[model samples]
Target: MMSDCPVVSTKLGKVSGFALAKAKCPEAQQVYGYLAIPFAKPPVGNLRFKPPQSADAWKGTRDGTKYPPGPMQSTRYVEIFAKYVANYRVADENPRYFDEDCLYLNLFTPKTSNKAKLPVLIWFYGGGFSAGSSVGYHGQTICGLQDVVLVVPQYRLNAFGFISFGKNSSCPGNMGLLDQKMAMEWTRDNILAFGGDPNNVTLFGRGSGGISVSSHVLSPMSRGLFHRAISCSGVANCNLVTKENNDVSTGFLLKELGIMDRDPEIILAKLRSLSAKALMEAQEISAEYHENPLQKLDDFVTVVDGKFLSKHPRDLITDGNFAPVPFIIGCNNTEFCGVLADRFPKGFVTGEIGEKQAMDLTKIAWQVADNIPSNKLDEGVGLVKKEMMRYISPDDRYKWSKLPTNVMLDTLILLPGVEQAIAHSDAGNPTYMYYMTQQLRMHHNRAFSKDMTKKPEFCEADHIDDEVFTFGVPFGNGPVAKEMKFTEDEKNLSKQWMSFICNFAKTGNPNTPMSLTNWTSFKRDDQRHLVVKMPLEEGVDLMGERFEFWQNLRAKMATT
Candidate 1:
């Protein structure tokens, strides 16, 4: 590995990285990959529960050939979800590699020399804000095909990353977000050495990572760090994205860890002293104790910490107080279906009780406030039920049913996404909205087979389908079964999507040269959004009436 590696000098020291192999791209350029480069000091021992610090400069050349250990987090849902209805899956945590000291990053560059000055695209992976790593995504294809510098950074996770005690909290939380901020600062100051244009940095992410991107836009500390943003299937205003306060779960975790002291100093000391495994287990036990998945989560998630985040992201955006940058916000046709399908069994949706169940599911998906009156709840549920019935047929089974899937899609993803686009556009940013409707031949959630009849009953594109195009991975070359093949249309769609994303990274607009149609900027009055499908077509008023119904109902409820 050392013989053919390329050596580069960073602020810390001189480092060597291996060249990427087998990426399908033009012969003129090759993708160079550097893995597990430390951006911050290892947050262990006394540094636990604290913000990240810059890594110590090394004396000799360091090898950045191998992937580093990821941050400590549970793999419970990942293992189960991987069996059937999931796209991105995390394998069981390897204790040997998993550690608290996981503040690392990876970089991929297509430029042979630092003079190239290509646009830099930074990716943040999403695992419900708990389970994910930079190693999961390889930047070879994205960088090689798009001719941009790609960077993936690792941040702390779960309780270790986001644990705030209370109002006068000892540990100022959002350490994970801070880690990302520091990574951006490092990129802005140092990316010029890696053949990247620091001023043209574009931050893009999926799911929880998208939520993080939106949060960064709303954050004062993250201002001017990134020049553009793309959020796929995530919004900061979504109910599940942020919490009012996490005191209940924080207290629960402390008691489970056998720390009786409520004092912040003592609690911090006890938390820092606990083993990494023990800390993870405490949160896992707390999650299990609160069996209801919809309510308060046991694992730590984002909260409105007064320091990093002053107010709700929606409130901030609505008031025209977020980072002013071009925005691309979108959700898949079936954003939450892959995971939500697991909750309903084979013949569960076949009666009057099924109606009640569907209503309950919609309520949970929207995270409806308890303060809303029962009459308003019934009105809202009735309207949603009417809208969902249009998609559900009588013969459909639980697995094939579109009722619950549509409800989840509208309530969780589409509505929040449009809401965000509206806010950003009104705030004077050039916002582009989209709904991804393409079903790729190769996707992690899709069970592949040559026989078309053997395909699963789910029709809509599942979560993370658009991710394949975003990363420039060809359909046949993905992690799915090898028997499947990519068609001409699939290849064209992938190329077109990649072109749009690369153009967005280069210039804030996604409308580029290759595609036949021009992606128009989002207009609040018409609410036009590009229906991202095989033959990309523009659609007016996406879910317009249905979304308006909910918005009106909400407004009416607010008045009463």
Candidate 2:
């Protein structure tokens, strides 16, 4: 008999988890879900600079009723980064809850009947190099809908995770990655107790989360940590720097604190003495780093410490020697729309036809951070939006061409998606690609619902659209748009996604019994994607004419 509610006693304590829904796994008995359990000792205060230590065993039955607090994030709403970039909102009253000690993971498990081991999927939330959390994200929805277990963890970000201290053992800026590794190690040790199979684990994420999965793919320390890897929307770019490039950004932040920093130990001690507000205040000086050349706020990146992650992520991917595991990866069609909108509001996205000034430098804020090769910088600066333009047809160009927003989706996002998918495929890894154009608009450009008659300008699948379906966190509190009217087509799309994912999880083949041609694996030289247009069919080239034009232009630029 399939059970809905099940209980498990963990090392920390006895806990109860209720399976919100039922789905058969390799073998199904009963299932339960638990949210917000500490996988490691929180990395706050003195523990901030140190690697993730073990979780101290608990004395009482711990409750996993709700998600734990998210990590110390930006000075804005929980989804401020998304709202700011995507021009959409996914916020709730979940006050931007943060703390350096934030280290939590949510779990969903099928009630196992003896030795039936189910594969696990660990989702890593991504928000540029800036902000994100696992809280409120739906782990149970996916797990219950499909028969796989789901786990999502929260890690430090920005200054906390990316703080660099040059070449010093005392500095552990990459503690964020260490936090993820610790959680994986924790799962290896404890997931079994929750009726999960530790041996078969897949690390997946979208956007920055995708980059995190890529990080693990390339990290030597991350080997054997996961069996399957999937990265969505976040490309090979936008990852951490190598060891040789670790700048003294933490020391600079300390200098902002009016302290002549000595070493990581001294800096951390001094930092710990300061209140959290004060620390955030110091990080604010990055505004100066944004404008000035000298006196730049030091770096805050995943330290390429020889001990932890041994190389820059791109190097590993290029060598065709990443964690040789089953791989699935792709990007969103409109990943850069919101961000480009933020940069060039109105129709400013159109570039110069002959002069070198047609593009907006601010459009690609991420690639500009590194002292990119002057040429690459120029290319990246214009490339994001230019590629977006490539996706619209000649007829549509007249409608969206003049205005930057029209082409923002295709150029900034889809182009990058194709680029990353090609890289993974060329690397001899089994890969998949997707172009999600399902823009969820409640009204005419308004985030919330509007009059029934009005249409929306921001109508295509903007950035982070894919994330919402992947993590089924419904709004129970705070403000949320009334786009809750998911059409039957949308629901069918979601169902297809769920079916495909579950199939992938079970056998590495996304093929459903019903040949849903809407989603297919890409072949080399076949620059096409599962055009997630309303009909959501899969077959061949989409926006082909524009794609060819953009490819030629991009190729022309690459040579120079």
**Candidate 1 lDDT, tens digit per residue, 1-560?**
44665687888887778666635545325667677888999999998878889888898988777778878877665553343321211112232357788998888887637688899988888877777777556666667777899888989988788888654566768888889998998888778888899899999898889988888888999998999999988877775657766676777787787788868888888888889998988888876654345543325777788867887766777787788899998888876555544455454333323656666666555443222555666666666677667656766565234565676677666777888888889878899988888875543333443422221335456676677667655621234323444556766777788788889999998876666678888988888888888888998887767778767766776786
lDDT, model 1: 0.73
Compare the candidates by TM-score and give the number of the best one: 1
Against the true structure, whose lDDT is highest?
A: 1
Residues 320-393 of candidate 2 have per-residue lDDT tens digits of: 65676656665555454453333333443332122222243333332333333455755555654555545445
Instruction: Please give the CA lDDT of all the candidate structures.
Output: 0.73, 0.58
Clashing pairs in 1: none
Q: How many backbone clashes does candidate 2 have?
A: 18
Indicate the TM-score of model 1.
0.90
> Which residues of candidate 2, in runs, are more than 4 Å off?
1-5, 18-31, 77-95, 110-116, 239-252, 285-288, 292-299, 339-358, 361-428, 443-459, 472-483, 539-560
Question: What's each prediction's TM-score?
Answer: 0.90, 0.79
Candidate 2 TM-score, C-alpha based: 0.79
